[model samples]
Target chain A: MARGHPAGPTGPAIRRAFDLLDLFTTARPRLTLSQLARHGGVPLSTAHRLVAELVRWGALERDPDGSYHIGLRLWELGALAPRGQGLREIALPFLEDLSQISRENVQLAVREGAELVFVERIAGTGAVPVFTRVGGRFALTATGVGLVLLAHAPTEIQDDVLGGRIERYTERTVTDPARLRRMLADVRTNGFSISDRQVTTDSLSVGAPIHDHLGQVVAAVSLVVRHGTASPHTLAPLVRTSARAISHALARRR
Target chain B: MARGHPAGPTGPAIRRAFDLLDLFTTARPRLTLSQLARHGGVPLSTAHRLVAELVRWGALERDPDGSYHIGLRLWELGALAPRGQGLREIALPFLEDLSQISRENVQLAVREGAELVFVERIAGTGAVPVFTRVGGRFALTATGVGLVLLAHAPTEIQDDVLGGRIERYTERTVTDPARLRRMLADVRTNGFSISDRQVTTDSLSVGAPIHDHLGQVVAAVSLVVRHGTASPHTLAPLVRTSARAISHALARRR
Candidate 1:
């Protein structure tokens, strides 16, 4: 027998459920029933039934204000993702060491398909604030971690990003496809990437690739500092060393 | 029209989908199709269809060895959960400080219904191996963080746990309902709790409650050490101070 339907007719239902979940992103963490209905392209009554099931299963929770947000159960399941929590767990000690020693913002992120998602970020008390959140997505052409990940991404993803709209964060952000392409090549050659006053005028980040046992560039680690206080070159070796240490640790894990 | 089913009969089908997700726990992170079928008590064909849909939506991923594991997208969605990542983000700095200071295991957790779920845990280089995992659940009667959370839980949840089976972890684990009731009272009175060799024979933990702006115990922070290395008295004040700092930080977050 087939799974749900003998003729596989329930495909649309499963897609609709995913569509409902996809409607809840970082930009829209909470949604009202009507908002969910509108965004999911479903009628209010349909949205109501889906939301009820999601809430019961702990995929979503109702706030005191009656708005709905993602629940702890989803987060727990997410922690089992090898690319997300698994990578972060192995790299945490190294990231902590970098954060403590440099007293700067240390971030760990990985490429998921074409986009980059922050897996973990440790903010130093006095460090310059950079706009990044764990599980948050950002353009692949604008940040240090992004550049390293984009550089190591497959050819198609690189082409897709470089071939599309590259949003400029600051005057220093590389929006030109040709120049960004050169920068990615530089990352490959230099073994590190730098975003100097790119994402934000006050911040500069140095990033390096973290490889898995199979030698795949599974993630990137970075140290962001106040631009005027330190040069990217001075920070490159430190970030690279930490990334290597993380890679070594990951290689040892079963 | 109803959500998945315009006829309103798809409620059980949607719920069965979630029940499948719930079967993936920390102890059983990956499962074969047969295992999921058996655990979910669904027909093998139904399990396969649902699993395929979930995998297609990126809620689940197949390992290279053909086993299924939670996917990165689910982790990304989980990151939006306020009780999980939200609390972890706020408490990370203090947890880092505690870990650095004592070179021990520092953990932050929150109560979800009747169970305590670990949100963040930082292990010292020399710290003893801990059983807790990020996004993992444990009984509310065995560990320091659990004790602190259980003490502050609502009346009904407290009664339900007191009325339920209290699994024993070690000889020192307090399994008697009457004794646990007194311990909960003591936690409220003393502003902290201790679990000496409760979860493991060679570990000791001290935990303190972290309150929200509403003065509710929203989370708990704890430090676990080798049993003979530190006295609970010496650790109590530190844990309490850290918890208070986190509470104050949480209060400042709109």
Candidate 2:
């Protein structure tokens, strides 16, 4: 379950089946039988058997080109995940309001272990381009939403991320452990976060945490814009208000 | 997986595993072990073992309340499905425009077997509330989008549907095979479909087909408004234009 690696030591048959699925990513959505056999560590015969079962089960789909990808059945199962589309459905209207008001990019994210997975993203017309896809994972250090999530995460998770080598995306990205810790603390105290050109040179983002009824920070919402076009102070109130609205919606639902 | 059954007979283990997954739906996203054992038609011990493996592989998550539901990792895998979120991503902007202009519920759907699965739905502000959920399935005979997709489906699929039982949702639903066949042919000739109060007495919808680069009808887009508020004639151009725009987006991406 760690990125491209197979799931930890289950029986080989189950592990092999999951490994074939784990081989797919946003960058590589399709795989040939040989690719599955080679990368998934199964023989061609075994790969064929497993794939036959998977396709029949609707876990994988065969294209007209004879390549395989994840199927609509898996997507239906995914929509039931509360942290995924369930949360996105409840948050979308508020995200739309923020996007329309700012005419910029809006994002919703949740922490999955020490990493963050984008749950939803909306880019306004003529907004600065952002490289984000729903269900894609990112490091805990670089982006505004990432920082806010890391700030509000459990202590064990914070320790795990802070104790590791931080991946930097741009020169403005804070890599030093002590400095990054200070930034997280600022996020908690200031009730928001600002990542200025941390992920990309032209982009800066302001993020705020979304809370559940229990007051746990279940998610984060952010606004990303061209760095020189807007100040973080100007965007902070907007992002914070939207995040609060989403949190209230979630609370009411719960 | 006919609505609510176990996956086909592959081997007991794999079929049981998939059956456990297929147990989830929008109406029932969470389940206890007893529920899984009973509904999934597996022994309690087998269900527990399968649930463990599924949880380890991130296909299911155990909630704090001791119930299990679909997990975010599955969502990550689902995002790779070209027919699901991948298609939704390309069509969303067009759907958004249509929703805003018409101030009605806009939907995108694709055929999965003889059934239609909704890929995306955007509800307009002040719009009549709709019950459709993303990734949820519906009969191909019920809605405007369903009729459009069923019309373009393969000959065998059409025969299979026409030869079987068609469930009617409202008094306006056309249940006779000949009438339904004529309606489909009209859809092909007119390049759009109108379902007047078929799914619900208060709702009427207009649907148009979306094609891939090869000109195959890969999806359908529709706009649903209150039956008394707007005629399908008034909505056809908007739905068709939006569907065409989405088709162009898919073509360009391909």
Candidate closest to the true structure, highest DockQ: 2
Candidate No. with top TM-score: 2
lDDT tens digits by residue: candidate 2, A36-106: 99998787877898898899899999988999999998888888899999899899999999999999999
Given candidate 1, what's the lDDT at residue A128? 91
lDDT of 1 at A86: 85
Tell how far residue B2 is off in model 2, in angstroms: 40
B107-201 per-residue lDDT for model 2 (tens digits): 99999999999998888888879998888889999799999999999999999999999998999999999999999999999999999999999
Per-prediction TM-score, please? 0.86, 0.92
Number of clashes recorded per candidate: 2, 0
Least lDDT summed over 10 consecutive residues: which range in candidate 1 chain A? A2-11
